[model samples]
Target: MRYIIVTGTSRGLGEAIATQLLEKGTKLISISRKPNEQLIEKAKYLTIPFDFYSFDLQEIHQIESFMEKIFSNIDVTNVSSIHLINNAGMLAPMKPLERSESEQLIANVHVNLVAPMLLSSAFMKHTKGWNIDKRIINISSGAGQKPYFGWGAYCTTKAGINMLTKCIALEETDKEYPVKVISFAPGVVDTNMQAEIRQTPKEDFIQVERFLTLKENDHLLSPDYVAKAVIELLETNHFDQGGIIRIDEQ
Candidate 1:
């Protein structure tokens, strides 16, 4: 059976992804700040509560231990493949860099960039020597490739993850038991994040109208739509040769 671990499954795109995976008979371990009642009802899902905002994920040893605990219950021999989907992220404190608070910036970095790095490392270390095919999908964003006003922290962290994906992909390619890694950009989806963007003051988020327009025009992709695309991509050999990929481009 395919075993998949997904972060940020409490809501939004992560929730949709987890739901679809469970429906397909994939065993899932969902990590989030709060338990998702819908996912918890699934027999194959194992919910692990982890508050990224409260925890110091920069502590690599703790991340390793956390992953170890999660993997301890599984018999690696029974699994055909293992997948890690780092889907948790935040876009907050949207303001110019000069106005952004240091603490908020650091927190954003930890959740968006540092946690994924640690989790990927722990996954690789723990799954070493296993013959199963391993894959890692990092939910990235278009903001990473292009700068947006008042999105300094968000853009920077996204950019960092993209580079992190590239670096890990390069390293894993040479491994005897390789892990395919892809930084997937899911185009603007109609989610809580978009709602937050739309509500932001024009002074803080100059492009708020753009998001509002998308919502008004019903142009935003549904979370489930993006989730389905992501799952299909994961099941295919298309992303085996990995790099930065955007769902919209597919």
Candidate 2:
């Protein structure tokens, strides 16, 4: 069976991705701060292999051990392929950088960038030469490529993720069994993160009204639609390694 390790599976795109993977009868391991009982029930009802682990990505230091715990269940000898989807992220401390709290800034960076780095590191280190398909998908944002007024922490971390993806791809270029890595920007979706954006004060986010307008006009994409595109790419392995891809372009 193909194995997928996904982060932030409690809701939004992550939840949609996990659900679809279950439907495909793939083995899945999800990481989130808390378990989504509905997903667990669905997996049981479908008799699909699923495992959920409660984890806070902000705990950067514990990430290695955490990954070890999750990887223990996989039987490398029987797996067709292995994938790591770093989907958990946050959009908080919506104020200007000067006014942002130290704790919030640190937490945002930890969750969005640091955790993925360590997780990918651990995954690569543990599965160095398995001679199987290995891929790491980092869920990124357009904000990473453009400057935004109040999204200093979020944008910087996402940009870091893009760079990290490229670096990984470059490092694995000459290896016989290279792990493919890419950053995926899923566009604006109607998720809780968008809600947070809509609720942000105009003074903090100058683009707040634009997002409100998008919501009013039903312009946001659905999580399931975006998840479908992501899963399609994964199932076919039709993606460019080291490239920064956008869902709209897919």
Each prediction's TM-score versus the true structure: 0.92, 0.98
- The residue pairs that clash in candidate 1, if any, are none
lDDT tens digits, residue span 129-187, model 2: 88988999999999889989999999999999999999999999999889988899999
* TM-score (C-alpha, index-matched) for candidate 2: 0.98
**What stretches of model 1 exceed 4 Å from their correct place?**
42-61
What's the C-alpha lDDT at position 199 in model 2? 87
Model 2: CA > 4 A from native: none
Task: Give the alpha carbon lDDT tens digit for every residue of 98-141 in model 1.
Answer: 88898888878888998999899989898888887789999999
Best by TM-score: 2
Quantify all predictions' global Cα lDDT against the true fold. 0.83, 0.91
Clash tally, candidates in order: 0, 0
